[model samples]
Target chain A: MVWLLVLIPLLLAVAAVLIPSGRLRPWLVPFGGLIQVVLVVFAISSENVSGFQGWLLLDPLGKLVLLFISVLFFICSLYVPGYLSLRAERPTRLFCACLLSMLGMMTLMTLSHHLGLMWVAMEATTLASAPLLLFNSSTRSLEATWKYLLIGSVGIALALLGSFFLAYASLYEGLESTLQFDDLIKLAPHLSKPWLHAAFVLLLVGYGTKMGLAPMHTWKPDAYGEAPGLVGALLAGGVTSCAFLAILRFYSLCVASGEAAFAREIFIFSGILSMVVAAVFMIRQRDFKRMLAYSSVEHMGILVLGIGVGGLATYGALLHLLTNGLTKGVLFLSAGNIHRAFGSKLTDDVRGAIRRVPMSGALFLAGFLAITGSPPFGPFISEFTILNGAIGSGKFVVAALFLLLLAIVFVGMGSTVLRVTQGTPSTPATATDFRESPRFVIPILLFLGMSLLLGLYIPPQLESLLKNAALFVENGV
Target chain B: MYQLIDPILVAVLLLNFAALGASQLRTVIHAIALQGVLLGVLVVVAHNEFTIWAVLMACAAITLKGIFIPRLLFHAIREVSIRREVEPIIGFIASLLLGGLGTALAVLFSNTLPIAQEHVGSLIVPAALSTTLTGFLILTTRVKAITQVVGYLVLENGIFIFGMLLVEAMPFLVEIGVLLDLFVAIFVMGIIINRISREFSTVSTRNLSSLKE
Candidate 1:
């Protein structure tokens, strides 16, 4: 089943290249996505406990991450066909192949237990996603692609250094040097404190770059802004989550070594800093896509903060991962529709999305509400849990500040979203442009429905998965 | 022979100095290529191994670093028709002095690390890190995309040197993967640089700064 999760996408990527018809290629996306999701279901149901040593693994955390990636990819895949169809001049074949390849690399990243293997997969994700960012091939897209490549490459390089430090930490402990997660965990207690400390910091900064956590988040806005809507959705909702999981894996090692407090401090500092950065940027954000990018940085902050707060907050953080992923999917896809509708992402230019395309506008508005942590939304529940955990942990000041930041972000994002969704259509609506095909609308609706359902009820199985994932983080391997 | 290699490390350091000092684009690329060749030779000497695979990898590194990259860059420079890196955001002497300070700081920081290995002292990691920092500094301070790519290559060389300290533990496959990725990355970046030069009439990142807030 684990093999199937990776295999289906790999196969689809090949088929996308082998099959020459551009029209036939777009279908490959949703088809591959759905098949991967089905395989994920099978893997989850079978409860496969075996891990392919020195390479892939299906631990509890991996399972949860795999599920998230699958679900997000499934949603984004539904949107891709319509997106590619609309951009009729561009070749869809490379786009489909790259997207599926990205999915495969991310799947591999989630399942990877060896640090070296994980690094390779993460690097592969960066390589695969660069072309996706360059889908439009404009000067702006080129700049974004360059920034993404350079920053991601640097980050991965630092991660490799950190992995070396981790291996060195084992040597310091008089244990056989290894980069396997299980082996590292087994040797955790004997590891040198200083090397472990350095390793954790390096890993956080490196992975944090990908997670878009504050100071290291310079590339997110540009890349997300330049990439197509579906591409943005996959990156924000899928790639970042996989990166977060990678951080959690290392955090688990720190916890086992009883050095978690040190790691938590770093997470808290970076997370809060990210929140402040996002809040400041969100205020004056004119471009809707860029605004979504900042929102992603903010949520990443919240996710890290949740983990930093610890205990039940870790559960909240894990849940926030799911919530943030789903909300971002809804927001980016719908925002894409709005961008397509107005032919601009500038909030000043895009007015009355509701009046323009009623379904997309409503979904956009709802996504805004959902993302801002309004009641009866997935993010709301998750944010509240985080606050509860913070307060329970006696971090009252942190909780207060967290709430304040959330409020500011809410106002900032809400004004932008509301401005786009509620105003009268400034442009005279052409009959041909106002109507988005069902292909695009269905994915937005699907993601919005999932998020709304999550708000209403937490399924027992998913609840268990989240709980187990949290435990895995708290207990290590 | 090991003691003789110390001056080569100094030569590597001087190459960075030369990079900082050189105003002409051609000189900078030449200095970087020299630094690459020096590092490649250093790798062979330091390892004291003549294994075919390791030697081939070393030669490939030298070729990519000293020859292929510089050649591609010269072509880019010709195509862009830019003569010098004008208005480098920092003056040459000051940047060189800062590079020195950065190198000094790297040594200071490396001393604080609790490295138990006695075979190699703190100098290698610190030198590599300082060079990496200087490369980053060049990348940010310089406006020209070609110079930035040169900076990136220098940065990768720094990382490669640092990786040498861990070569025993780091698998060959991972090393190969890193090199391949780096090659492709530069190739793609070179293509982007060409496109940027054509569209914007300049490869300065400032010209591409239209998408900001």
Candidate 2:
């Protein structure tokens, strides 16, 4: 059974909590992440991972999400030692435990075929990650955690109801109200039309809120902006990825029920609205960290919009998931270093980052370019494919609007990023003990390099994984 | 004849209004706690058969949602020592009217669903939905963070009511897991509320406006 994949990190987290040494507990994070990565690689390499009646199968979609989360968690794990060593005054015990448990929950979320188990796992994730926001113990962070919990819990609560409506959908057809994805897919044709539609709407709003989709994306800017950069990266990349995977499972159900067209239309509208919201906020954004938050909102928009446009766009959406995640790792980590050196998130206090921390400043700039779809980066390739898919599908207005918003965000974000990266270091910014350590710095460079490599060459293995996952989502093959 | 579950469900729905119309924090918390107890009873009363698993789940619900979590909320309010919802965004009567409108809408809406024939006339679906809507109303309308937490518990109680529709098909493990998650969520929220009250000297979300751009 693949239960081992999830249980190990959780067990290790408990161990981390029990360990007497505060200094040693933070190190447990990287160790837990490494074990998770190794186990994920092994699970993907060797088949027959299902157990407990097909509830834990590593299907192509799950495999792909598993791979991204593993990579994201592993990289973020490496930075933990560097981050915590600098902030020794603060306690790392709960932070380390929550971080590891979050990985376990995300893994459980992707792997579970049972919708009931998935909801349990998904809600568990919200509970686990809540403390990560409160790590800083500041009033703003406290407020952020408050909004995060209240809004996010309400959102996931709706998802719980959505799960019920879905199970009830099966019951309406005289089938046993089984929530296993395979069973639901097999019985999709017989599911009641009205209930199925209701299920989709609720699941979309519910998971969409978690995914930070527009109108429902209110909590994103607050939590992401207030969280420490390391936690920010995880929330943006790992937490949101789990939520997106949940949506994909439901999207697949829609495909099976032949509500694919209706789902696509809703996805398209939500996708575009998120970008417009992101773009509007991106303009005149003063805080560099908050700018990255809005950027996350935009990329999340692109992910759904890509899939909604269909065909190769689905493949692009899957690939975009990886690129966007890695690029966020680069941006948030580098931004973390800069934030420490400068002690401010706003552009006003953070002038001439290049002069202050040469390497990180350049990265924050390059990350901005790469994320905005400049050439020779993975995001650009994935984004181009989506635009091509839109054009190929004759969604010209969507394509045009997509292009326009991309430009506006690029220019909007450009001013803030450039203002941070360029110019002379303001004199008061010079005296921080914080320095760019190669330990944390190397991770960002590696992430950027990998994104660059993917833009130039799609590894055949990843390409195949994306293709199979896309096909699985679009057609229940 | 209606099953024994219907009146209990009505009591739960009325508690939704009690939570909305009541201004005192303790009273609202008590109403939600009572609703939680009703929902726990709902599981056994609504079940088609009274197996060990069903009885055990109903007990679990009562202890966690009814007794344990509400006690936590009570302590939270006691910690903050705020007795009333004090200065709601909308005053009490208007909020009650809004709650009534939502209850009406929920009743009208559940009729549109193709619920199972055996469960058609039961207040299960509409009561579940309207209670949920009332929870949202309290959450959005109330200013104090403790009241918001109470609103959240009420919301979960409503979802728990809806969860009954699938109690027979759902594994006991999932039902227990759901309750556990709800407990932890409240636990975390309670902790944060204490922190917020200490930090700002007030738990009103109005003071939370500093984080905005």
Candidate 3:
């Protein structure tokens, strides 16, 4: 059953490539997305979904990430047909094929129970997404794609080496070396401590690079700023979350091995560092899309910070994953609309977006507020929970620092958001004929609606699932 | 069989330096391809027994890294009309010095991690680390897009050398996946380099700087 999750998208990806019509190729994306969402829904509801001789299994953590990726892909898919039709001059063959393959690879990453398998799936996602970044075929987009591919590949290479180190840790102990996640956790204590520590650092840096954490996040602004809004949202939201899941897998091993203290300190430090970096770059930012990229860096910081704080904070981090991913979708999709309507991503040329395309403009404002942790939004609840968890754990310094950075990000991000949303348009909307069509407008609304819904209420099942995942990570089930 | 490993490993390390020092793009790619072939040979020699899995992995590595990938890159250069010179950001002497420094550091660094008893005397760990670092130096110091790709391949070679230590532990599927991913990455990168040259009328990364903050 779990194999189908990966297989369906892969098959659809082949069909997307074979299909002759440029118009019809893109529909495969939404079709593949819908099937994935359905499969994930069933996988979530059912128990013990395992396949491929136990190589793939949808665990609690996997379930949450799978849900986010599938639903996010679905919503993004709804806008694809509309988005592609607008650019009829360009062929959709590569774009559609890559998107579906990426979905398949992401699904495989989540379902992978073995570490090597996870690394492969993660690398596949990077390869699959590179072409998507070059969709515009502009010089700037080409540059962005190059940076993303090279940096991402180097980071993943480190991760591959790290996996080898992990296997060697056991091999050094004269035990049968294996990389099955469950087996590693079982053998954690007996594995060489130095090797484990080294492995953890490499994995963090490698996966963290993919997650767009600080010091390694140089590619984020460029890639996110140059890529289309939909691609940016997926990279920021979907692909980044899968990378986080990879980190969590290793972190869970550290916890099981009783090396939580060592791992936790590093997490807290890097997490705080990422937020500070985001805050610095976001201030006085001319490009609104680039500012959102920084904003993503900030939220990724928050997620890791929550995990580092532990206990209730881990749960907060888990919840923040969902909230942040969905909120980014809202921002990117609406931001895409605004970018199209205004024909520019810079603040100087993109003012009074609210007037130019009222519906997308308002959604953009709401998304900005939600992402900054304004009340009545999903991010507010999640961010506050992380704060409460930090305070509860008596990590007063981390809590204070978290709040300070959040405030700085809010203020920095707010100035640019307002500049884009407020004031009169410096140039008229004649630059691009893109208007607020229902196809594009509806998905952004649905994403915003989901973010709002998640804030107001945590349905019983979701709360339990989040709790189970948090517990599963805190102490192995 | 194990006694022959060190000499070949040392050759691989020398190729790393050769790649670092070579200013010509053709020489650098050839040096990397030779390194890839040596690593592929090292794959079979590193293991105690010549198992089918080891043989298969070695063949694949040689074919993809040594022949197919280099052929693709050469075609890219030929088609795109890229100049032969690497056009490095730093001088060749400095890059060679850095490669030397990186090799020393890798040797020093590998001593900290305890190797298994059988593998303790082997130079695999140190050689792997040094190759990876050299790859990094090339990747960072080189300005041409093609040179950067060569750097990336070298970096991957370093990891592949490291993987030879655990050839038995890693599944065949993953090994193939890694090779396939590397092939596709270079293939995709080759296409992008072609486009970069066509669009900008030059393949130099100086043209790629307009997307900055």
Candidate 4:
């Protein structure tokens, strides 16, 4: 079942490349995404924990990340066909192939137990997603693609170096050096502290680059702004989660070595710094897609901050992962629809999205509410829980600062969203032709509904999963 | 004789200095190739029995890094007709000085770590780190895209040397995967650079300032 989860997407990627018809190729995404989800269910239900030797295994954390990526991919896949149709030209087979290949690589990143294999998978994702970001082939997209490639490659290379440091750390413990996560955890306490510290820093920077954590997230805006919306959704939601999971694995090692406090400090600094940076940039952001990018930065900050706060915050952080992923899915898809509707992403050109494409505009508005942590929505609930966790842990100053940043982000994002969604149609040409298709709006609605449902009620099974995953982070099991 | 390779690592450090001082693309490429050759020698001399497979791989790396990539870059540069990486964001002298300071820092910092192995030489880690820093300096300071790629190659070489310290930890397949990924990434960047030159008529990243906030 585990092999099937990994192999199915790889097969689809190959098929996407081999198939000549552009129209027929995109269907491979949804088909593969569904199959992956089904396989995840089967894997979770089975009693076996160990599988695939040194290469792949479905531990609790991996299972959680896999479940998140699978569901997120499935939601974003539903939005792809409609999003592709909006392109004036026929979709290239390359786009479909790269997207599926990225899907495969992200799945592999989630499932791989070996740190080396995980790095390879992460690098493969950078290669796979670069072309997708180049879908428009505009000069700006080219620039974005270059920045994404250079920054992502450098980050992953650092990660590889970090992996080596980690392996070397094992030597100090009298253990045969290996890249397997379990082996490393068993040897964690005995490993040299200096090398472990260096390893954690490198790993944080490397994976944090992928996660679009601040200071390392210069590429997120350009890449997310220019990529097709479905691609943005997958990247912001699926790929970033996988990278966070990688960081969480290393954090687990730090905890095992009794360096949890050190790890927590770094996480807190980076996380809060990300949030503050995101808030600052989001205030003046002009492009809608760019706004979404800053939101990604802010959410990544919250995710890490949740873990950094530890205790109940870990569970809240895990819950925020689900909410953030779903909310991004809704926003990116709806933003795609609105961008298509207005024939522009510039704040100056787009107006009265509600009057034009009512379904997309309304969902975009709802997505905005949810993303900014407005009440009665999923993000609000998750964000509140994280804040409560912070307060409960006697982090009064941190909690205060977090709330301040969140409020600033909410205002910055809300104003921009309102400006785009509420006004009368400013562009006469776009308004006359604007209409919401069910294909686009339905996916947005589904994602929004799922996010809202999670807010209203946490399913007992998922709560258990989140708690178990948190335990894995708190203890090194 | 095996200890003779220790001094050659100093050549790798000097090559980075030459790269930092280089204003012309041609000189920079040559310097990078020299570093690559020095690394190939280090790899061969550092290993105990010099198996045929290891020798062949080193030869291939040397040929690719030393010859083919530089040649391809030169061809791209000539075709684009850009003469020099003129007016770097940081001046040449400052970059070289920074490169020297970076080397000093690397040496100072690396000595603090408890490294178990002695045969690998104390200089390998620092040389690799300084080269990596110099590569980053060139990458950030220079405007020309080809020079930036050369800088990236130097950085990769630095990382490669660092990885050598843990050669035991790296499986053969994983090492190959890393190399293959680097090759493909550079190839893709090369294609993009060609496109940038064709579209914008210059390989400088300054022309890419159009997308900013």
Candidate 5:
């Protein structure tokens, strides 16, 4: 069953590369996404299938990220068919192949129980996304691809070093060296303290770079700004979640080692720094897409800050990962529609999105409100929970700062989103031969609806999943 | 017993300085390629006995890190036809000085970390730290994209040094040289380095600043 998760996508990716029809190729994305989603649903709901031992297993954290990637990909897959059709001038053979391959690796990443295997899968994810970033073939996209690849690889390489350090930490303590998470956790108490601390620092810096954490988030703006919206949605929502999952694995190891406090300090520091960095850069941002890139940095900060705060905050952080992933899909996909309509991602050139592509534009606006913790949106619920967790744990200063950063980001993001959505439908935008097609708009609507539904009520099953995942991290077995 | 490992580790350290100090791109690549080959030798030398895993690792390190990666880099430079000189953001000599200072600090820092009794006096920890720091220095200070790749290679090589200490745990790391080879190909976008050159007409990352705040 675990092998099926990786095999289906790999086979479909091969099929995508082999298929010649430009018209028929992109359907492979949704095909692979649907298959994986079915597998995940069955895997989670049935609970009868035994997972592959050691190399692959879906724990609560893995299950949560797997669900996020599958849903996000399925939504983006639906968007891709429409997206590729509009740009029918170019071939999408490589794009489809790489996208499918990325799904395969992301699935492998989620299911990988071995640290070395996870590192390989994560590196593969970085490789798979490079072509997607460069899909436009413009020089600017080339620059974006260059930065994204170089910076991302460096981070992964650092992560590789960290993984080696972690393995060595166990060996140095006179234990048999194994990269399996189960063995590491079982032996965590006997691991060398200094090496464990060192490993945590390097892993945080390494994976945090990929997660777009501030001070290490130099690649986010360029990559996110230039990629097509569907690609950005996957990169932002899907790839970053995998990195967050990687961090959670290490953090759980820290918990097993009884160094939870040490790990939390680093998380809290980096989290606040990311939010502060995002807030500073976000004000008066000219490029709307680039502004969204900063917004991603801000949310990543919130996710880590929640984890760092612990107790209820850990649960809040876990829930926010899903909410943030869904909301970002709404924002990026809708924003993509607007970008397509105007053929511009700059705020000066594009406006009146609401009047132009009413469905995507309204979703984008609602997405902004929801992302900023506005009531009735899912992010509001998650962010409020994070707030309760922070203050509940007597982190008054962190709580206050978290709210202040959220307000600043809201004001900053609101201005850009409103600037893009408020004015009369512009001449060039309407002239781009783009329209509010149901195919393009439905996915955004589904994502937005999900977020709204989550805010109104938390589903009991998902609540259990979030609780289990949080417990897995805070109190590793 | 430690006689063979000490000289090899020293040679690796010398190559680090050579990479840091080289002005020409060809020389820098040569230094890095040599470092890659030395790292392969270091893998075998660091191990107490020759086994299939050690041999496989040495071969992988030589093939991927020592040969294949450098070949791809050379192809990138040749295809791009950029100037052979490495244009440093900070002067090469100053960077070399900084590299020395980092090496010194690394030795100092390694002493602070507790080590197993068997490996207490070995240079593996300090040398790895220094090489990684030097790699980072090259990446930040160099202006060209290819040099950045070189910097990354050095960084990986440094990390490779640590794996020598935990061979039992990191068996796949012996095969990691192949993964390292893939890093250059994928990061350089297989053949898109040529396209990047044609688009921008230069391989300097300085020009990539057009999209910035």
Candidate 6:
């Protein structure tokens, strides 16, 4: 059953490539996405689903991430036919194939219980997502794709070394070395402390690079800015969530080994550093898409900060994982529509977006509010939960810093969002014929609605799942 | 293990320095390819006993890293019609000096990490670290897109050298997956390099600077 989740998407990808018509290829995405959501629903409800000799399994943590990715991908998939139709001049074969393969790889990454298999899956996701970044085929998009491939590959390579270090940590203790997550956790306490520490640093930098954490986050802005909005949404929402899940897996190993304190300090430092970096860049940003990238960096920081604070914060981080992902879906898709409607993504030329495209414009403004931690939006609840956890854990300075950064990001991002959404068009007519359509508008609306609902209420099943995931990370269930 | 592995590891380390000091992209690419071949040999010799798995991995590593990827890069450079000589942000002399310093640092760093009893006295860990550091140096310092890819290869080689310490621990499927990913990554990079040259009229990353904050 678990294998089917991975196999189905891959097969769909093959089907996408084999089918010739550009018009038909786009529909396969939503079909694959729908299948993914259904499979995830079943997988989550079942007990102890394992695949490939138990190299892949859905734990509580995996389930949360898998569910978020499925739902996000499905929503974004709904926007694909509309998006491809708008860009009918460009080829859809590569775009369709890469998107589906990326979904397959993200699923594999989430389900991977073995660290090596997980690394392979993670690297595959980078490869799979690279071509999607190149969909625009412009010089800038080319540059973005180049940087993404290089930086992502190098980061993932370091992650491989880190995985080796982890395996060696066990070997150094004279134990039969294995990268099975369960075995690593069981052997956690006895593993060599120095190697374990080194492995964590390497893995942190490695996976952190993937998650667009600061310093290594140099690739995020360019990739997100140049990639199509749908790709940006998936990259920000689906791919980063998988990487965050990878980090959580390791964080769990550290907890099992009683090194959570050591790990938490680094997480606190990195989490704060990422947020500060994102906040600094978000201020007066010209490119709305790039601004969204910075916002992603900031949110990634918050997620890690929540985890760093631990206890209730871990739960907050887990919940933020889902909220931030869905909210990004809304932000990027609507922003994409604005870019298309105006034939520009820069504020100088993209004014009066609301006048240009009413539905997406309002959705864009609403997404900005939701993402900036405004009440009645998902991020507010999750961000507040994290702050509460920080304060509850007695980290007053971190709590203060968290609030300060969020406020800064809100103001900085708000100015950009408002400028794009509120003003009159600089020119009455733009180059693109793009306008508000149900296919494009509805997905963003759906994502935004989910974000709002999450903010207002937590379904009982989701609440329990979040609690189990939080506990799983803290105590290594 | 030490007698056979040490020489190959040492050659691999020297190639790291060669790649750092070399100005010609062709020389750098060859240095990387040679290092790949050497690491391929290291995979076989690092083990105490010969096994079919080691041979298969070595073949895949050599064919992909040594033969196939270099050919692809060579084709890219030719098609892009770029200069063979690469301009480094850091001078050759400085990069060579840094490479030497890195080798020393790597040795010191390896001494800090506890080695297993069976792997005692092997040069694999230090060699891996220095090669990785050298790759980072070249990757960061070089201006040309092709040279940067070469740097990434060096970086991956360093990690592969480190992998030799626990060869048996890595499953065959994962090993193949890693190689397949490296192949596909370079392949995609090759296409992007061509596109970059076509769009910007140069393979140097200097032309890729428009998207900065």
Best-fitting candidate, measured by DockQ? 5
Model 5: lDDT of residue B192: 42
Q: Estimate each model's TM-score.
A: 0.96, 0.97, 0.97, 0.96, 0.98, 0.98
Flag regions of model 2 displaced more than 4 Å.
B83-85, B171-177, B180-193
**Candidate 5 wrongly placed segments (more than 4 Å):** A48-52, A426-430, B189-192
Docking class of 4: medium
**How large is the interface RMSD of each prediction?**
2.6, 2.3, 2.3, 2.4, 1.7, 2.3
Model 5, span B145-205: residue lDDT tens: 8888889888888888877777645677545535866877665655346566778778888
User: Docking quality tier of candidate 3?
Assistant: medium
Write model 4 residue lDDT over A31-52, tens digit each, in one string: 8888888888788767665556
Provide a comma-separated list of chain B TM-scores, one per candidate: 0.88, 0.90, 0.93, 0.89, 0.93, 0.93
Write down the TM-score for model 6: 0.98
**Per-prediction fnat:** 0.25, 0.65, 0.63, 0.33, 0.65, 0.60
Q: Which rank order by lDDT, best down to worst? A: 6, 3, 5, 2, 1, 4
Give the backbone clash total of model 1: 0
Candidate 5 to truth, TM: 0.98
What lDDT tens digits, residue by residue, belong to model 2 across residues A1-477? 599989999998899789999778888988988888888989988866898888888899999999999999999998998889988787788889999999999999989998878888888888889888988888888888888877888888888788888888987778976778998898887889898888899998988888999888888888998898988999899889999999999998998988899989999999999999999999989988988988999999999998889998999999999999999999999999999999888988888999889999999999999999999999999999999999998999999999999999999999999999999888565478887879869889988998898899998988888999999999865
Error of 5 at B50 (Å): 1.7
Comparing 2 with 3 on DockQ, the higher-scoring candidate is: 2
lDDT of 6 by residue, A201-312 (tens): 9999999999999989999999999999999999999889988999999999999999999999999999999999999999999999999999999999988888999988
Which stretch of 10 consecutive residues in model 6 chain B shows the poorest summed lDDT? B172-181
Candidate 6 residue A359 C-alpha distance from true site, Å: 1.3
Candidate 3 i-RMS: 2.3
**Cα misplacement distance, residue B84 of candidate 1 (Å):** 3.4
Candidate 4 wrong stretches, greater than 4 Å: A88-91, A429-434, B117-121, B169-177, B180-190
If both were scored by lDDT, which would come out higher, candidate 1 or candidate 5? 5
Docking class of 5: medium
> In terms of DockQ, which candidate is stronger, 1 or 3?
3
The residue ranges of model 3 lying beyond 4 angstroms of the native Cα positions read B171-193
